[model samples]
Target: MHTRRPFRTLALALGTAGLLISGCSSGSSSSGAASPAQAASVSPSPVPAALKSYYAQHLSWRDCGVSGFQCTTMKAPLDYAKPDGGEIKLAVSRKKATGPGKRIGSLLVNPGGPGGSAIGYLQGYAAIGYPAQVRARYDMVAIDPRGVARSEPVECLTGPQMDVYTQVDQTPDDDAEVTKLSGAFKKFATGCEKRSGEVLPHVSTEETARDMDMLRALLGDEHLNYVGASYGTFLGATYAELFPGRTGRLVLDGAMDPSLSSIELNRDQTAGFETAFQSFAQDCVRKSDCPLGTTSADEAATRLKKLFTELDAKPIPTGESRDLGESLATTGVIAAMYDESAWPQLREALTAADAGDGSGLLALADSYYEREPSGEYANLMYANAAVNCLDLPPAFATPQDVTKALPSFEKASPVFGEGFAWAALNCAYWPVPATGTAHRIEAEGAAPIVVVGTTRDPATPYHWAESLADQLSSGTLLTYEGDGHTAYGRGSDCIDTAINTYLLEGTPPPADKKCS
Candidate 1:
């Protein structure tokens, strides 16, 4: 039930224009060698004989149901280590560039769900809402990663089962509650193994990055040009590492540091969400209708925590089958922390929750889970756990480990720490062994890669962006001293111009260049 922070906010926040101002700049920062633009050879590494067909396959792009967009499918090895063992089809989509400017190449984008549909992202916003100049010169492309939406999505529990899973108390107050939470995790793991055991081991970020290279070749591009946000940044970074020579114009927004272990990531993210909430608290106290309090940020946070305490005692009715409990209310708050524009909504939701109407908070939690009106949930949470559990070892191996980590997590964020710490236990019961380990991604020979960070980002915190930029040999750091998840296209003309210039001109912004 921990959202490892979906990068979907890139589209969710940017999708609404009137809600953003987009200013990002930071004070002192550090970066690695900022190399000038390195030409991307159309000729990437020679295709291995095993992958020749996958590389040479033609995409039969046709009108997707969505206007101005085309969709196609491409084949990839289900188990990349064992190519030809079997094939899984990946869904791809594109919007061809308009005129008035020469086409640069295909600009691939991922909104980061590990489960977020890149194809959906392209159609929903990237294809049409991106800067016109950039769109004019590039074919906006997206490939739903192997187990994500549009592709053969990894299935787990049914709608009713997921409902039970989401409502399971994350912050266990006693042994019985703890046992219940642990049982839920085991059941989820068993369900996923029963249904998607085959694909679970194959959905690692490393595999998805390889899939991108395949899509790159099929698109007839010499090098890959991409914009990845949140978890997408990790995917892009992995690609750059795996195929440094073929990386071109990569913009890793809201970058993630691959060096952190699962424990480190979860703890840091705990602190990050707290940081974002603090920012929200400060802003909230300035408004007259602030539910927590207008007295002060500290008081507001205290009040919210007190509300969570009350909800733990008795859940509030949402006018639906589901009620607003501590777990869902926490999720609702975390969802709003992704974008500042949602702060007002969070305040209103909290106000309503305080008044015994939990509908608003439930709605927010539903959106976070990608729950449909039909009561079915998107594969988002399922695939999120799939990719995360496979990409790194479980954050905690047992309930005892969670108990040991609670104090440290609480120190990170007193409000969310306990629940977040317990949430990390969700993956401990995974059926598959993790295939990836936490390590630095140097991508030494890649072209100048742009790494963006938001100072108060709730997920994929600013420090992760700084760490990534420092790790990559040719990374250029672009700091956004602002709130929200990803920076580009969110309204910072500075952020947009810098990234667009990099994508269009192959010239990254100067290292440590803060956005304004």
Candidate 2:
């Protein structure tokens, strides 16, 4: 369900909330003071019964665009437990198959980021990027989740407030700075409640997964056929758990393991960034554009760290009042970690930054933040925080927990540990109660499910693929010994062929499929 675009748009440079971390603390739910009676009735159900009727009414589609595409809306109960209560609208789009043969069904595609816009993916990529033959036989579809774009989105800070938030130091120098950083996170959280309170509590991934089933029913598909990338893998796997019997051909790439808590997720992700940095370092040593010293990767890392520190103290002016500083620079580097293809561009940016020109690096940071030249933000970051905060509670409950866990994160990536951990602090003061927990998904009754892993994937670690494969009753592990986030469309002919064969026919690849 995710696409790892090599180059980012201005706003995408900030992050894709595709993974979680562990060891962060927690607090009481933030859903606010419900009466005891109302609270008592609010139990998490295994499956909401109201979803069936909701699905039935939502399947009808109307004209969307070009000849084949259709658009519609699906309604989900604001709270799954109160299914017949207030509802939320989810926007749906589909491109019907141009088939000369029997149609398979709807194949839902998600482009990673628990918050990424499925509608955007459908319009921009899935409409054309999917294999033509597959497009010919099955309807390709997308649905923007509850608090994502097109759906009722969650907005926290305004443009000016966000500019300030983006500039918050990810790595604090001492107790005073840590308090300042925590205050920023609290402000963002409070802003969400103040600006978008109504929809904030309903954006959990579990809720989204249930919404997907409603989409499946409306589409009249007997089973759910899906291809999920990055965080999309998590959503698909969750669906398999809830509706194993209704699970069809499912593919999860850049896999995330449900068994791992937030801390573990963050630590592993930090290590992944390290792996990617090492790969970049190795390649940079052989390239003329390399910015860091060529003595060794260690020297390169040290030099980069020094540069980051220097920028932290005296940020380079990018002509704009909002210029590239150390925190944004660090974020920009981490964004490149998502795809190895961006290495050359990263090298260029680093070289420019080293030469006292911060525009290149600033541009990269702007892309991550999805910031436009005028300083407005795309809905990406807002939706990301909404979905993430709703899906899982805070990774760390308090600043003290972050301080205690710093060493472990530092061990993961000496350069990025502190920043990532601080970023995890955003959910601490979430407006809604966290509805899900870290649990393994067996997806026991499903048909054969293919799990693909890119060995050096910075977003989702390779070990997670192995873990998920081992956990699933009918999971098959497919390995791509390459550098990148996901493997299928990144030029591994073997990988493409294997998945294509599986989707076109009913056969999976060889059990031990490997692509180098």
Candidate 3:
């Protein structure tokens, strides 16, 4: 059926860097006052002297390859438990405010892949696309968390190897195919251990959150002002939980519920994608060019399943040497479901594939894998599995586990069920045992935090935002009654205005505000 993108968000177009710059300034005190009762409820261990030294060190910034963006490297302990043990270099990037008025402090933005490159996101999108008024008031900053791009990345397969990995038939028809898929997963996991064994155990979200605190201190900000999407939302929440007194103006869009086990998360995500596909199918049938017929969503789904079966038997050839197989074709469809703006493109790809041309759909799949025309790939998928595997227990510990859960997963989404069920096995073969566990994050004394949820987000379901908001001690839920992966900066003036007001004025919207 459908394949999932390992990472969360798509890359924004890289734009020309500007020539505006501003200075970093220090400040104290968060927007919301922490109640004494809230403060007393959770007493955290004091920062060790060695760790404090790491946090207090200054960053030496210099002009980067991008015009206005400055880049620097910060050292973080590989293991927080042993501050003096070993260190990892983190890549940091920033674009200072271009202001006509007073500056507000630094504002950090993360485009959530868990593996997504925050530095790339900042220079490519946030620095240029964020609200100008907000940009004028704060230094837009991003850091590539350990084991991600630009920092010391987690390397697994080579481009050609990854190509073969992505093409593996996810819906195995027999024991041999299932064994082959398991082999593929084992090969991938083994590759990560061989290449990145040192960093694999320390790349969990909790460690990344700790790194953010160090970044905040180095940037001289008393509190963190941040925007996180998809997996990044989980990260921002972790920071709030770990550093409640330092929490400030956090916007968590497309949020994830930390309390979910891997099994629940995967099952929920499968259902989410099914919901998104229903929406797409309903809209697709209305168009004359739609290849899946205009009868109904069920009919469209049946037609799609038939197409996938056909591709499984005989893949269609593309302009490039690579052919469009069931796995790639399914991934292409899933990618388009992330943003409705891509629906037209998905339709055209489907029409071409139905007519024997597979280039368009292959291109979409290529983009999802970050596969360059030269057959090169970024480390996104590798890092995605690295962090995801270490953050929580595996969804399936063995093929038997997947077999037992297959029925329930299929019930979640008939079209994507089998594929996702097999895909969840990727983490089961991981070499490193999970270092973290699913738990509630109260961030007891944290300031007002804004959690934005789109009604039908495929990756991070809406109910997750509701759950997270309810879990956090001071979380406020902001609902966008629409479709898409995230809400803010996607053409809703209402959402943009509310978020901008929150970041600039330190006041969030009403606790349960709903925007169209």
Candidate 4:
């Protein structure tokens, strides 16, 4: 596929430290026939050659039992093409089946990020939040994917380097600022190659999907039963594409569209953020503490946009040298879009920003960037970039591509499109070239796959969930008309009950199931 160079773009996404970061990245694809499915009753396939040597070198298992749980490590080839080239160890943990009757097998979990550590999710959330019956009948498992935490990580920049990078003016105007921004991008990319060249090139979602297959075999399961969130949905969809028959009771919440090119993905996401912003705006107008307009949602948006423009020209000073500029302000706003829970906090931040006290907004931005009070960064951004760069090729090749794409992006998301479109360019200058393309994933004959979407989800839009559901031959759309990134575990009892029933009983939710 033809790639275009991207121009400057703004950014935002929370990583492992449980905060958001504003930036962009790039990715690759895989070519291999999935193993044919056998009867639901059968012995596990032999470990793939790629996993055997990997298992020997990197894994060291120990006793880990949290009530009815057993933890272990699973190893696989870093590069599927050359499985033996080297191995990357995945941190695997599982809460074994506590059955009332016949038990199925292990059900793996991934909490998105493309970089969000599944093990972290398993320990922090899923191990407790998942429905009791589902937890009772099946082994709830988690694996940190290659280049993600607990695996061979991909380190890009240090805490201090990231501090500078995050503070860099994202919205470039004059040539000098653009040069500075581009230099930051170059430094971040080069740092990835320099610090993690060995595995950076192999961290694509497709590779991670393949790794899932190997784990399925090693766990002695006949098929893979898994639940994925946010970017995890993309990973699950990719797995379904590659190993259709092996899929079992899969739940892809906060679904991502595999067909959209980088430009389309960024544009759609930009619009999604605007939709979320509109929701927040409408809510804010009704609330007294709203920093923006107290009238219509559009008025609130207009007020916010004007602030963004003003900040672009003259950044407000925080107590620290780093102030709330257009980039950081945008980052704070986008971070709020991820979860409605953050809306009030964002309003406070905006109030602070409006009053020329940018500390609140900076804190929000810092949370998004996952920068702790101590200034250390979790590996989330590094792994996010590594996986993104490997999943698909660059979105832009030159500044002209971004320019050409700007109008369409703006139309898609009047608030966030241009910045996101320009942000897509960050991959253009990646040290490792992208090897993947936007492709359709039609998991024909796969067991019914439950796809969950939140109506006002920020990171992964609801429509993408609808599109992915339509694309997968057996995908069943389960809608949660609510706010948040992923719906299953975010306090939606109905959503959780529906998914839990499916996971435990193997009965898919109704095709058009809607839970408010």
Q: Mind giving the per-residue lDDT tens digits that candidate 4 earns over 1-516?
A: 001111001121243324221121221211112223433322344556645755334333344534434456576776788775776777676666666855677788887776776776676667676776777776777787888777777888888888788767765666787678768778988999999988888888888888888777666666788888878888899987887767878999888898988777777787777788889899999987789978889889889889989998888999986777888788778876777878888888899889898888888777666677888877777887777777777677766687788888788777777677767777878887787889888877677899999898777889999999999888899999987677876778889889988887788898889999
Q: Write the per-residue lDDT of candidate 1 for residues 1-516, one digit (tens) a residue.
A: 574755647236323211111122222211112223356433346888989888877677666656666677789999877897999998877788786776677889998867887777777778888999988888888888988876888999999999999999999989999999999999998999999888888999999999998887777676788999889999999999999888988999998999999999999999999999999999999999999989888898899999999999999999999988999999989888888888888889999988999998888888788887789877888888999999999999999999999999999999899999999998899999999999999887787899999998888888999999999988889999999888988889899999988887887888798875
Q: Residue 431: error of model 3 in Å?
A: 0.7
Q: In model 2, which regions exceed 4 Å deviation?
A: 1-49, 58-60, 65-68
TM-score of each: 0.94, 0.89, 0.93, 0.88
Best by TM-score: 1
Q: Encode model 2's per-residue lDDT on 346-414: one tens digit a residue.
A: 898899888777887777777676677888776677777777666665688998898889899888888
Q: Count the backbone clashes (under 3 Å) in each candidate.
A: 7, 29, 0, 29
What do the candidate models score in CA lDDT, each in turn? Answer: 0.84, 0.75, 0.84, 0.74
Q: Which segments of candidate 4 are over 4 A away from where they belong? A: 1-60, 63-70, 98-102
Clashing pairs in 1: 22-492, 24-480, 24-481, 24-515, 25-481, 42-222, 113-116
Better of 3 and 4 by lDDT: 3
lDDT for position 261 in model 1: 96
What is the Å distance of residue 243 in model 1 from its true position?
0.5
- Please provide, for model 3 over 1-516, each residue's C-alpha lDDT reduced to its tens digit, 9 standing for 90 to 100: 222332344435111111122353332222211212222233444667878889767787777756677877899999999888899999888888889667777889888876778887888788889999999888899998899887899999998999899999998999999999999999999999999999999999999999998888788776788999888899999999888988888999999999999989999999988998999999999988789998899999999999989999999999877899899999888888788888889899999999999898888887777777899877878888999999998998999999999999999999988899989999889999998899998889888899999998888889999999999998999999987788888889999999999888888899899999
